[model samples]
Target: MKQSAYEAAVGLLSRRDHGEKELRSKLLSKGFAFEEVTDALTRCKEYGYLDDSRYCELMLRNGINKGWGPQRIQQSLKQKGIADSRIQEMFLDLDIDWFEQARVTAQRKFGSQVQRTKDRQVEMKEKAKRFRFLQYRGFDFEQSNYALEQLSL
Candidate 1:
């Protein structure tokens, strides 16, 4: 027999936290009716089994552990269907220093050797490469430059 919407949602939550949109999509894909899905979601929220704020906090902590910057984390949260207002609120209260994160990420990746190059052109190229890498890692230019400076010192 097919599982009920509540059962399916509970089972999914047993494995890991899921955003409301993600859980709803999964339930719909499993052939649950729209009303049933909505009801299940509401019940879960009412019971404290589903919370976007908790999910956001977990994602933010995980991202920081993995050396991800705020930009990337925000983008990821948005993609996961988290509301912009919640995301902003979480960021506002977060104590993480993004520039320090950038520095640590750079140190972890390239070590303090970023300033060893003596040739001006080669140094420029190296700095450019580091900039691109940090940018790809979701750091802004100012943060990236600050990281490079820290490495030079």
Candidate 2:
């Protein structure tokens, strides 16, 4: 049985939400014509089944839950076809303190490593490793440093 583009789109959305651009790409890759994909997207929008703002909000919350920093979250949202202005607006409205988030993330990741060691060299190495992990998590130097400081306490 050949399913229509709208049917396929709804099926995909039933499993999870998707941004319009991602949905369109998936539909196109499934061999639907451009016009079919476009129509399906439009219909989905009309039904309020496809909302970029809702998708962005979900992604942002998911990123934070996963302990991802703003830089990484922004990049992920952009990849999902969210606008920079939208992302910035959401960020402004968010009450999260990124510095505190960084500190918490570091503590979760390296709590045991913060134990005092007789060897200053070992302590320095541990700090470096923690800093690198924070950086890889999209935290900037100041955020990472603040995290390291907090973890030391």
Once superposed on the true structure, which residue ranges of model 1 sit more than 4 Å away at CA?
none
Q: lDDT tens digits, residues 57-130, model 2?
A: 99999999888888889999999998889999999999998999898888887773467889999989878888
Q: Relative to the unseen true structure, what is the Cα RMSD of model 1? A: 1.4
**lDDT per residue as tens, model 1, 71-134:** 9999999999999999999999999789999999999999866446557888888888988998
- For residue 124, model 1's alpha carbon misses the true position, in angstroms, by 1.9
Which stretches in model 2 have alpha-carbon errors above 4 Å?
none
* Superposition error at 69 for model 2 (Å): 0.7
Return the TM-score for each candidate structure.
0.94, 0.94
Whole-model Cα lDDT per candidate? 0.91, 0.90
**Total clashes for model 2:** 0
Q: What are the C-alpha RMSDs, in order, of all predicted structures?
A: 1.4, 1.4
Worst 10 residues of 1 by lDDT: 112-121
So what's the TM-score on candidate 2? Answer: 0.94
Error of 1 at 92 (Å): 0.7
